[model samples]
Target: MKQWLVFPRQKVGLVCVGKPVRCSGQESCSNWRAISRTQILLHSFLLFTFLLSPIAAGAVDITQQLHRSLNSSVGRQSRDEADSLLSIGEQQYASGYADKTIASCLRALELYHSIDDLKAEGLTYNLLAKAYVQLGSLKEVEDSLRRGLAIARDTQDFQAQIFVLNNIGTFFLQQGESAAASKTVEDALAIAHGVKNIEGEGLSLSNLGLVAARLGDYNKAIKLYENALIFRRQTGDAIAEANTLNNLGDAYLASGNYQDTIATYGTAMQIAKTNRDRTNELRAIDGLVKAHSAVGRYERTFDLLEQPLTLAKELQNLREELKSFESYAQLYKQQGNYLTARNFYERAIILARTLEDSKQEVQLLDQLTKMLQLK
Candidate 1:
């Protein structure tokens, strides 16, 4: 039988080199004296190997095969390799390359599973979930999130659990299950509080706000979002803070507080611009356009849509382009310019056809017919 020696400071048990010796306290622990040089070297080598194990995994990479072979030969790849892959995946995701993002994350997930690294596995699942969401694969997103939650639970990783739970809540919200979303995010909030993780708590609060907003509880949602914004700011999460502000703007808009909506969205837009977060910036611009139009600031609405339309083209985002065209059509219609509205509606229909969105194309065609009749 192998004897074990416990190191109090390290909180690890080392195999005894010879006969086991008991110590009453730290002062009497003399097992170090019995450890041979060769045994110490062996232990050191093992410790080094354990320390060098991969910290995290993420999406695919161009040199993925090379990295995998290197990892196998060296027993582990460097943290830089994992970070690089993660960066690539994020870029791909932002660029709307859902398939590439999925492929990268899947490869990273495989490596993580091979190493039995639960933390990495959980994170990779989150990445995969986002990619699936972009691809409109709701079932795959659900599966990915469930797997991530399981890994977090099994590993007793409280932070990871909170993240997975928050994402699950958001998924529920997207599915129009507001009550379920609220319950799930509440669970996440509890776990975040238990772990004293500020970031997790903030995210949970924001997600809960989303649930409330979906349920038409705009005041409650505003309060929750304001609280979340504070936490996000404290944690230095500018992106999260901007998102919360945008949510708050939406809540205010729902409550018929047009001025507040405009103000909140303006702040969010500034933050998004400073952070170079184009997605959030676009969201803020959309919010501003609505708020401005509500207040009869038609010219301002058109001015706001200008950059958003330009950005949609630059990003090759057909969906946003369609939205921009529709907004323009609505603006012209509201100004009583039937001809201009008809022209914009035609442009929107063209874009919808390019996207192969039959339903949207039909809707736009109907609107165009109506506008032409008005003309």
Candidate 2:
């Protein structure tokens, strides 16, 4: 028998294949919210494409049976089956099985619709949106989120409403509609505050900070991030707190506050390390390197680059590996070490070609060509 990992649906305060779990405080909600938000944001970076292919399946048989049960009846039994399917779908999503997650969620949605379980249907739509995000199906993502939003409103599920709104804002942010993103997140913030959902409120605030940062309002971004950090800390959400610290560091860096940037990123790095979150750890390290470099701390910058470079290789994340090489090359170029810079640039170009990232390849080639001309 294949072991299936189960996770609670924090937003809905529902547990699947486990005892009841309650979010009594912001801190209590932190772990689930932090994990979910990280997964969502990671996928958001792959804006126009999927980063992973469907992996081998282990829960296929059980999910298939759930689908059959959900489709075969229309009564209390069917409703129970729908709930099971939704639970399984959530599990699949948490397990990183995007394709299976989509299939399971769709079946659950159908069952919920048949039973007029609008709230459950709405949640299913939210799950579908996430799966669609992983698949890079922009249209599907939009449609599912919209549908989920509508259901949340119709059912007056304030928590679900806030979650959907935040996701929509994030999607808009990724699409480069900063103005729309800001407005959407502001709406989410207002609703979250009204509902006294500290977790939702904090997340919205963080997203709004991102929008502000994108708009070059670094001061405003920092202030918002600070407020979000307070809420994240209040809830004992180490991951969320770390992410906010990273964002705060980014704002400080943008404003040329290298010392503050380094301090903030260091805190984030420590938290990421404690959480064993490699992605956030890499982000913190990247931010630290840039800040150190800006302050002429070349030794620290070079030292900081080593871990992310190794971590990128371990993760087999070509994009991050390419980033490491490019950063190394840029730093060498800044130091007038053309030969070293050229070597790193060549490595970056090779990774870009392997990843079939034509745009990045072109950019690297152009940079290398310019470096050669200078030589």
Candidate 3:
């Protein structure tokens, strides 16, 4: 449920259940031509590692209607048995068992389809979309979402429509189709407003903020995030609040408003800590370190980075770890410490290669080459 913004260069995205990653430089990021179609699938789906770690903020919960639909299906089969699989599939998805979720959902899908329960079948497709994303299967993701949307509309299930629309918007954002993303999210927003579903409102607003940010319209992004925050704060969901703040902090940083960036990131860190969300805590710390570094607070910058480096390694978030190395390289390069900077860049390149992020490896190498050239 991460809000995401895909750009041409410096590819800002997030990896947690939150937003998109942002690279350190403004170099062009045209991966489409060089990478295969399978790689393109990763483009829109892999934002969790680098964007701004918030899983899908305000994840759409199973509504009562959806529940009944799930429980009501399965002709000639044991009704209780099918319900159990559907329930287990939801549990598997929540537990991050991607393969299990897919298995459970596929089985459940057959039962629902056999019963001709469009609402239930549509919900199953939506469930499959979640599992497919983790597998980096964009083709499956698109197919699931399209089927879900069609079912939602055919059955006139307004709630299901809102859910499918919001998801479709996020998918478009990953595809780097901001215009389509915007339109799709706006449709969700309208439906949410009509239904008075505040969580939907917040999710749609936050996603629109991502679209705006991708378009380099920080002011608009900030406004949308603020509105989203208002709705989130009312929901008593601290994690969602922290995610929005992290995203808003990034927007502030992008706009050169360092003080606001610092404040926003600080708040995000606090909320993440209270929730014991180490991944998001790392994201907040990264934002703080970047803001501090940009304003020449070298001592504070290093201070801010140290713990997060350890935390990132602990989390096995290679991209976040690489980001810290890149930050170290940048800071040392600025201080005329070329040898130290080169060492950090080398480490980062290795990590990027391990992650199979060729673009990131190339970016790190470019930074290394530029630094050596200066020397």
Candidate 4:
């Protein structure tokens, strides 16, 4: 019978070796013996000492403090603080802190609405839509994006309209309504091309490419990605260029062109590192892992997974954590380490469930069931 044991480690019960060998969950717990009184004392001592250091708490509370400060301010200070909060919220949203992001963005929206800042209101709504999308609140996403889009159109702000359109299309794409997404994005693309807005065109093209890729049109996806890259370069948008390069890499990978996939991702990684775009850099690493795995490059796959895994843990990003787990699971599965694969898959399942990501949960469950059956 499988043993039911108490999780003695401080972090979580994430690390447990079987006949397959696992490591301690806590890095500091490994040197200790079983959960003895002395070991518990030592653990408490270490945790307290660590918390008292300069790096105590890892100090992420600064943002929350800032948010609090903004709430207490008035006039110019309030407006300025609100602007700062918006930036912080956008960063959090991009990093997948959906609930926190929504709170921050809503705070910003309150300030902007109080001041009658239509542009700011529109932008905040868009950010709110992004947060709702991450939370899988489809109705909230639709409402927020539509409100922003209406405002942008009413103001006749082409740039703002383009931004809202892109986000709206992305929302639809996330909902698996690709045809509607494509129509909305195509109109945005036409407008961008008409106004010669290179940045807008690049973004729209990338969205179009992603839509095509989701539809299994690898050739069209590749073409759109390449064209987007061209526009990105012409506009000196290195971030967008790197993103399109990564997308192209994915297209080639899907089509079984490992060499091209590797080369494309390599270029994207170089650019991402140069730009210090950790998000895109992690994306490139993910692509490298997939491409290398397709070619049976086990060592390369492990190496590729390590950077993103470390980064995700360091950043405490749930999205990156899930991606790292998936990558690890696939690599272990490919290497015939079914036990390790199951471990990572279980970790991913935990995260997916926390995020209420039904799609990912169902997919991971299917993989986990298949792997367990093989045992």
Per-model C-alpha RMSD: 16.8, 11.5, 9.6, 17.9
How would the candidate models be sorted by TM-score, starting from the highest?
4, 1, 3, 2
What is the alpha-carbon lDDT of model 1 when measured against the actual structure? Answer: 0.64
Clashing pairs for predicted structure model 1, backbone only = 59-104, 59-105, 60-104
Better of 3 and 4 by lDDT: 3
List the candidate 2 regions with Cα displacement exceeding 4 Å.
1-144, 147-156, 174-176
TM-score of each: 0.72, 0.66, 0.68, 0.75
Tens-digit per-residue lDDT, 1-375, candidate 4: 000001112321111122111122333133111211111110110000000000001123323322232343465566786788888886686566778888998898788777666666776776676566455555565457556755666667677666566665654454455776688778878888888888778778887887898799999999998888878898776766777787788789999999999999999899978977676688788788878887788887888788987887787777778878987987788778999999999999999888666767888899999988887
Candidate closest to the true structure, highest lDDT: 3
Estimate candidate 1's RMSD in Å.
16.8
lDDT of 1 by residue, 225-278 (tens): 989888889888676777778878888998999989999999999998898767
Highest TM-score model number = 4
* Residue 127 lDDT, candidate 4, scale 0-100: 63
Q: After superposition, how far is residue 105 of candidate 1 from its true place, in Å?
A: 3.3
Comparing 2 and 3 by lDDT, which wins? Answer: 3
After TM-score superposition, what is the CA distance of residue 12 in candidate 1 from its true location, in Å? 45
For model 2, how does the per-residue alpha-carbon lDDT over 1-375 read when each residue is reduced to its tens digit? 000011111111111112112213343234223322212222222311121111111123223322233343456687887778877776565444567888988887777777766656666776687676655556676567656655556556677767677776666666555666677778878998987988777777887887888789999999999999888788776766777788788889999998898899999999988977665687789889888898799998999999988987776666678888999999999999999999999999998787555656888999999999998
